[model samples]
Target: MKPIRALSNADEVVRLLGSEGDMSPAEIAERLDIPRPSVYRLLDGLESIGLTESVPGSRARLNLRWLHLADQARESMVEWAGARELLSELVERTSQTAYLTVLRGHEAVCLEWEQGRAVGVLLLKPGRSLPLYAGAAGRTCLAFGVNVEEYLDTVTERRAYTADTLTSDAALRADVEATRRRGYVFSDEDVTDGIAAIGVPIRGSRGQLLGALSVSGIKVEYLAKRDAYLEALLDVAGRLASLNEAAIQ
Candidate 1:
């Protein structure tokens, strides 16, 4: 692998170790198909930052300290400039939880979300991240963020999170095209069952893709006020698009 790619492999290793806990260096190397020495180096770096811990028999466990750090980072980003107030306005106006997300290496990572005064699962809450090929927010990012077909080619599994998920590459491509044409995305029970989401791409003042602005709620609730909700989401996205880079990060 190229040195740059190898450097990034550490982050993928971190995510894997975080999700699948208590893995030995050998096991992690096998899972990632990298060298054992590289795994040890990545583990050493993670350990220095307190994101992982050595277990019995030289295994590694994801430390809870990472979650605390994540929480702090989320808090700081939310409180950054206009983010918190905008998300709050979005939630209050739509009565559905609103989320702001950014694309991090083909994955859409949630930066912040605001709970609305409605009943919903909130499965894609803040700090959670997912593949850009799935969900409304992720699809919006896929459509406007990069070349959809090329990006999906790099993803390994296109697993269906629900019956409505677009699993086939052709279907995903079509969906991305439609999202581009519509300038937003509308999804029902695609990522999480019983939840519906509508999203639009948020671009910076210079037209750089900042992230996605999405609002999710129970499907029944969405069906009842789809038009009004779509309008509100579009308005929120427009406002988000006008934000400065300093205020957006």
Candidate 2:
């Protein structure tokens, strides 16, 4: 059996578990092309670090204690509290539903949301997940300062939710390019019929893509005053980005 180094062995085990989910030492060894004895030793070390846990008769699973640590790291972002305050302000100003979003793997997840005075507007709640190519927030996130081709390739297998959704590679790529140039994106009856949304990317202190901020309302009301709404959306996005930068610094 080859002698296993600690860092390389631990990383190999983590990659195996992450991609293949829970598995026994023998299974991990087979997948990693490592010795079974070495795999068991690595698993023991991982369990000691609180990164993996073993079940008596079942396969070992990721401990998820590190997830708590990840959340803590996210919360340490200097701008989180200020971003929430700005979101609230934007919702109040527009009287349309507003949200703050962040990318989570192949999806966008709402981190904050506020409902305006609009009667029937959809109220997105925190933790709501959306397809990376389906909604305004997702489109904005995918288009803003990211490799459009890479993102499209990653999300190609996912189904579009609406007929108007940009599922085709060419169309989606074009949309992404346009969004990057215009600095925002608009979705009319794309995610849901009778609904319209406008979104702008929020950037962090180091110019990292924070996520997106969007305002949504009924299609009829939105279309009648599209230009005005676009301006408002851009204004809010800029303010939120600035707020995030300041808070972080």
Best by lDDT: 1
lDDT of each: 0.82, 0.77
Per-model TM-score versus the true fold: 0.81, 0.66
Writing each residue's lDDT as its tens digit, candidate 2 over 1-249 gives 334466787888886786577898888888878888878878888899899999877588788886787567657765666666776777676777888888877778887777877845553556566777877898887887457778777766867667788888888888888988887788877788778888888777677787788888887777777677677777877787777677756
Count of steric clashes across candidates, in order: 0, 0
Task: Write candidate 1's Cα lDDT for 79-158 as tens digits.
Answer: 23477688999888888888888888888988888887887656677777877878878888888888776776778587
Indicate the worst ten consecutive residues by lDDT in candidate 1.
75-84
Candidate 2 displacement at residue 64 in angstroms = 17
Runs in model 1 with CA error above 4 Å? 1-9, 22-27, 34-45, 55-59, 64-80, 120-122, 205-207, 245-249
